[model samples]
Target: MNESKEFLKEYDDSKYKKPSATVDMIILTAVDVETKARSVPDKVLRVLLIKRKGDPLVVDITDPYKGKWALPGGFVNYYEDLDAAAIRELREETNISDVYMEQLYTWGKVYRDLRRRVISTSYMALVDSSKLNIKAGDDAEDACWFDVKITLLEEVKTQIKAGYIRKTTYELSLVNSENEIKDTVIVTKKLEGRTSKIDLEYVNNPSGLAFDHATIIFYALERLKNKVEYTDIAFSLMPEMFTLTELKKLYEVITGKVIYSRNFRDKMEKQKKMVIETDEWESGKPYKPARLFRFNPDWVEDQ
Candidate 1:
C-alpha cells in the first residue's frame, strides 16, 4: 500500500516539473484611408520582430525579409496573466501603445521552438500604424511595416469550378436538358500550403531581423479572414477616421477577396460592433471629402 501511495505521489509531482506553456497573440487591424477621393483599404498588420542572438529553429529568409522580420513574443513570466503577458510582449517588442489586442492562437508544435517546448498562448493586436511610431526593443532587431501579399494564383491553390451537367441521348436533339444539374468541384490535386502565402518584405531592407516570421504573417492573414466578419477587429488597424470604400478595401485584404461596396457595407456596418470617428474629412488627398472613424472599444467591452 505504501509503494502504491508513493508511486501516486511521484506521478502527481511529475506534473509540476513540466513547463507550462504560455499564450502569444497575433494582433491584427484594418485601416481605412482616403486616397484621391477614392477610399483605400490597408491592413494594420505590423511586424513585431526582434533579433535572436541564440539557439532556436533555424530558417532562411532568402533574398527577402532578411535581417528585420520576426514575431513579437517573449517568455511568459510566472504570475503574469496570459492576456497581460501577450500585451506586455507586444509593448516590449514594439514601442507602441493604445491599440486593440486579442488572443489569436496557440502555436505549440514541439519543433516551434528549438531551445525548448514553448507552447505559446498567442494573441493578436490591431493598431493604426499611421498614428504611432514603432521601434525595436528587447530581443527585437528592429520593427517596420511591410506590405502583405496574399497570392490567389491558379498555380498555387485549387480552383473552385462550377458548371451545368447534362447528358445526350443517341438520338439528335435528345440531350438531357430536362435533367440538367449544376455541379461544383474542388480539385484537391495539389496540397494547399500549410498556410496561404502571405508575404511581407522590408519597406527598406537595412535592419537585420530574425526567424520564420513570414509564417506568422501568413497566420495573421488567415486570422483576419475569420475575425473581420465576426469581430470588430478590422478597425484596430485603421486610422482614427475612414470612409466606406476604404473600409471595403480593408475587408478585401483580410478576406483575400474583393467585396462589393453596397452589399459589403450593408454587412460590415451592421456588425454594430466597431465604428469610426466621423465628421472628419480628407487629410492630404485631393478628392471628394470622405468621412472617417476610429475603432470603438465599447463594442468589445466585456466581450
Candidate 2:
C-alpha cells in the first residue's frame, strides 16, 4: 500500500485543464449622427440588459437575477452552431424580434470563470431603438436599458478629444414612448479632480451572473469605440433627421470630445459617402433646420 501511494503521488497534474464555454454577444446599438455621418454609439453609450432568472418552475417568475438587468446572453449548447446559439439566447431571454445579427468576438479565458475555465464568443447585433418593442423572455426577470456613463469634462468638452474622465455614478434613467424604468443597481464613477485620463469607478449587480461578465461588459465598450469609426452603428439610435447640434452631441457622447463645428463638417464632406436629401424641417428653435441626409446608398458598404 505504501509503494502504490508513492507511485500515484508522482502522477503529472500539469496536463489537467478545465472544460471551455462559448459566449454569444448580444450587441446593442443606437443611432447617433455627427454632422453628415450617422454612426452607432459605442456599446458604452447604450445597451439593453436583462436580469437572469435561473429558476425553471417559478410561476410569473420571481427570480433573484430576474430583477437585476444585464445583457441577453448565455452558455453555448453542445455541438451547437455558434450563430444558432446566439439566436436561441436572444429569442429565449430577451424576446427580441426581427433585427440584424452578426458575430462580434470570441471570449475564452481561463480565469474568466471562477468556478471553472471557460471561453465564450461574443456576437453583435444592430437594432433601431424605435423600431422594436422589446420584452423579457423566459430566463430574464426584467429587461431595461442602461446608458453607459462616460466622462466628459465640461472643460474637456471645451478642450481635448479624449481627456474627459470616464467617471461612474448611480444617477441613471431614460424615458421612451413607454414609461420610466430602473436598473438593478446604479454604477457610480467619479474622477479625482481633473486626472488626465478616465478610470472605472464601481459597478453594482445584485443578481450576479457568474464569471467575469462585468469585465466582459467593459470589453464590449472598447469594441463599440473602435467599430463606430468604420460602421454606421450609432445611427441605430437617432431619428431619421437631425440638426448639426444634435449630430455633434452624438459624437461628443461617443468620442468623448467637444468638436469645432467647421472642422467636423469639413472632415465629413470629404468622406463623400453621405447624401443630402432635399426635405427640410426645423426644430422651431432659433437656428434654421439643417439639411437632412442619409448614407450614400453605394458608399456606405465601401465606407
Best prediction by lDDT:
2
Per-model lDDT:
0.52, 0.55
Per-residue CA lDDT of model 1 for 108-176, tens digit only, reads 556554455567766666665566667767766655544444443223333434322222111001012
TM of each candidate vs. truth: 0.60, 0.63
Error of 2 at 51 (Å): 0.6
Rate residue 178 of model 2 by lDDT.
44
lDDT (Cα, tens digit) per residue for candidate 2, span 53-139: 555233332232334345677777788887777788888877775667767666665555445566787776656666666688876
- Full-model lDDT, candidate 2: 0.55
Misplaced by over 4 Å in model 1 are 1-17, 20-25, 29-46, 54-68, 153-213, 268-284, 291-303
Question: How much is 63 displaced in model 1, in angstroms?
Answer: 22
Best by TM-score: 2
